[model samples]
Target: MSINRQIVLASRPQGEPSADNFRLVESPLAPPEQLADGQVLVRHHFLSLDPYMRGRMSEGKSYAQPQPLNEVMIGGTVGEVIASRHPQYAVGDKVVGMGGWQEYAVVNAAQPGLLRKVDTTHIPLSAYLGAVGMPGVTAWYGLMKICEPRAGGTISVSAASGAVGSAVGQLAKSRGCRVVGFAGGPDKCRYVVEELGFDACIDYRQHATLDSLQAALREAAPQGIDGHFENVGGMVLDAVLLQMNAFGRIAVCGMIAGYNGEPIPLRHPQMILTSRLRVEGFIVSEHMEVWPEALKELGTLVATGRLKYRESVAQGLASAPEAFIGLLKGRNFGKQLVKLI
Candidate 1:
């Protein structure tokens, strides 16, 4: 209890990420002797593992700044406030914030929008980091604001069984649109359609080649795709482009397939021009203004059991590296998380 455990990036990855890139270290759980005003100490219980973290590990031009090496890996954490010298926060309050990959954090309550208490009455505590947190917000903003679903229209989502994609499909369905998803395997495809209420689910692995993927997508989405919420950008994007309806809209949330390999190129860049498609890529963090409204709606859905989600949890902090590596390979199902408590 007196030592703070951390999972820090030991080295940048080459190709697919591995456990050897992360190093675990321990530091004394020490607080400042003279507490600054508005200071609070947090003990992290859960940490979110996401695909974006892969980008942070590499020193490359990205939408977000690279995470510093030899420091606790940057991530979202939900924890309890154990000590507070601030007016707003109090001991025992459950809060969600970016406390990184550490067991403890000392943050100033006056820090603008860094930490906030979460309501755990109707929603599960861990759900704050998954369904109603950043991922949920990402889904909401991308699907509603960017994709702009049309009722009775067809929407195709890639990485359909994971955190952001699952929310996107369900949300689109709620708008009276027919939603289809591209997941990795039969099991995930089944879950996307049967459990998450998607109209059709395509197993991308079953159709690895671009031609096969295009055929499968065409078969699944007979009407052509009106909107796309893309997660895996390699073959999935290519296939979707071929099936795109005129004036189709694409909300490019992530290109995870290229995270560990050579950058994926669009097989048909001309489709955007010929078909008059609207394609927009976004980083969720850059748009914080929409979060309040987005989280409110997403939270209500998850709490009422209308929005469904699943989590793949690793037991401890030490497991984050391996869990993260598996995430890049599409090994974990649903939302990947690490439980430090």
Candidate 2:
């Protein structure tokens, strides 16, 4: 453990990122005895690969600062404390924090919200990076707080098989709403309907045009969509707009279609005025107060087996770049993680 291995941002991407944008680097690790008073050494077990990280890689203006070149790529990590010079942390403590793309990290445990101890008795340590973590909280806040669906109403979700979208559908179903999902292919569509228990799942690829997608949505959501959770934009959003009921609420989570710098101009901007839709975009990190409440429900659902989740895991830290690229292309099923242990 004398050397720490990491994936650093080598260059900013122009559109789609390739392996050239990332570089693997190694650095000498200071011994436990040489650590500063408030610092702790952590050995990362798992690293999370999220879509939002793509936004951070660019130098453009964003909600958060862009990832600095030649630094460890920004990410969420769950690990074990190997050495501690802090009062609250001790060796073997299971914790979660922003440990980035490195196999090991030395961070100040004294910094509030930087590190947190988690219980693995009910939920696995890896779940701290997924369902019972940020993605789950993002789902809860967007669905419950923004797109409030009433019982017997219909809810439409895009990117239905993804980590956040899956949770949004399941949580909405629990509240007695008829949930319909929109996914890329037949296999993903089947999983969304049969496995995740959505009322129906539309294979968006089959309906390549806005009019075609709108026709399919009409059948799945016969009563019209009362609430919508959008993940993919472009044609999908346009179709959802056409089917939305009057005064329907929409929670805009992601626009992965435009992440590669493609222009996603809405075909029908006037639909918002005609439908009286309330569409709001949110960044989950900005609302910290709701996390505790969100995590409590998400943790219980996951622990009790009511909330089912999936993960596509890569073998080592070196595989992160490929795994992340695969995620953007929808090659990975469910939550994507890189195992560093």
Candidate 3:
């Protein structure tokens, strides 16, 4: 139990992530055998694997700094505090914070926004890293704030069965927007429509071409898309652009189609001008002030069963790298998590 095992960034990915990009190692936990002031030791129960981590894996600048070579891969975790030198954090308190890709984290209390307590009595702990956490906040800000979808109006989002996308569609529907989703396959499409209760879902794997995607979008959203949450860029964005209603809003949450280093070109710039559309790219951390309000709503929705989600769980720390690669490949159906304990 004293060995802290972690997955570290070994190299930058050339195209898609592979085994060469990550390496796992173990180090003795608390080698000095003493707790330092302002340090809290947390034993990770679950770690979240998000698309944003992909951006951090690459060398270029984006919203976050790249994952430093030989360092533990960065991720969010829900853990129980085992030792606390900080008065603010008590032993046995459950907290959600950046524990990285390790089983135990000795986190400093001063990192401002990095650590916070969460109540798991009404919600599952893993969910704090998903539906009611960063991804959910991302869905809320990008949809309610940016999209502003109205009742009876059609709204669409890509990767609609994934973490942020699923929440986006559900939130839109709760507001009475006719919701349509773009998922990768027939199974995910079924889950989006039947389980998540979206009005319609497009199996984008079947509609691989831009023309086909336009056809599918037109058929599913016959009223014309009033708002869009853009998780996928490239062909999907271009196709959705053509079907947008005049003055429609697009919240660019993520462009996962190109996250693996491929260049995903957006083809229809003319539509942005012609439709007088509003498009904005957002990072959830940039809008942290809205988290409390957003989490309250999301938590209530989940507790009441009005909001639902699925998960792809990898059972151990050793499985993190492969599971992450699966996530980038759209092999994961919903939120991807690693069980570290």
Candidate 4:
């Protein structure tokens, strides 16, 4: 008897997505008889708005395919099960999965890589969509596996106050590596260093050029960067490459700086060969097997006051468009979420 409100793609975005690209429509809820055996009906509570979703708005193929036109925009969400024909999940159980930008969905329990029941007793259900979710796992596996920083070494991270970036800096610090972070403004830089416990943080907005960034980094870590967690590509990455020590490792998590179709030329290819640096680009979904272990470790760290997280939450689904626009514009302080009833 319930009807669902959903956000569907009205048109493919040429560059950054605007409110006009999304069309909110109403659809009749799936009938109980249509529910497959071991399927459940879920009402969405929290929706994740990520930078990667911007790539999905375009038609080009990358790590994941673009969302088809008129289809619901795909995203990770936390929801409450309203009706369950499945033995594993009961009514009122909270779960996290790819629920898209919709109010309700019928999910098949037997579907491979579907929803996972969350234990909300220890952490808030929203954490599953942020810290303990894909972003956390992305930070953990990318840094530990790709850029293995040794004790007494130095690691540098861009967008260091962001969800994944913040996690990377803290994890490196915990491992005894000196951490340096790069954020947009003075406030975020201060938060990264003072609140997030980073060894040092540079305000990229204040720096006029790559030379200034280099000078700042040199002062922060006299030994030079042994490992780099790259979230923003372009001149910043080029500058970092110039300061890397021999045999440095780079984990390429994202290219937020050039996400809006900016022209960013590769200026320092010689660093990879001359410095013997290993630069690897990774998609977090490829390392799904390690998620449980990462979650356990990160959960313990957060619960024990070792790991810290911050979220910038939008009040409702109607605010999702603005929140997403802000996220792309670097307006969000941390992980951005849309809280929907």
Q: Top model by TM-score, which number?
A: 2
Which whole-number lDDT from 0 to 100 does residue 176 have in model 3? 91
User: Candidate 2 regions off by >4 Å?
Assistant: none
Stretches > 4 Å off in candidate 4 = 31-34
RMSD of each: 1.1, 0.8, 1.2, 1.3
Q: Model 1, residue 83: displacement in angstroms? A: 0.7
| Clashing residue pairs for model 2 | none
Residue 8 deviation, candidate 3, in Å? 0.6
lDDT value, residue 77 of candidate 4? 95
Candidate 2 residue-wise lDDT, 161-217, digit = tens: 999999999999999999999998998998998898999999999986778889999
> Best-fitting candidate, measured by lDDT?
2
Candidate 1, position 94, lDDT: 95
User: To one decimal, what is the Cα RMSD in angstroms of model 3 from the true structure?
Assistant: 1.2
lDDT by candidate, in order shown: 0.91, 0.94, 0.91, 0.89
Poorest 10 consecutive residues of model 4 by lDDT? 257-266
* Count of clashing pairs, candidate 2: 0
Pull out the clashing pairs in model 1.
none
State candidate 3's TM-score. 0.97
lDDT of 4 by residue, 1-341 (tens): 46888888899877777889888888999776677788999999999999998888887767888888898889999989988899999989999999998888899877878999988887888888878899889999888998997899999999999999999999999999999999999999989999999999988888887788778878987898999999888777887898899999999999987777777777888988999999999999988899989999888887677888899999877788888889999999999999887
Q: Say which prediction, candidate 1 or candidate 2, comes out ahead on lDDT.
A: 2
Per-model clash counts, in order, read: 0, 0, 0, 0
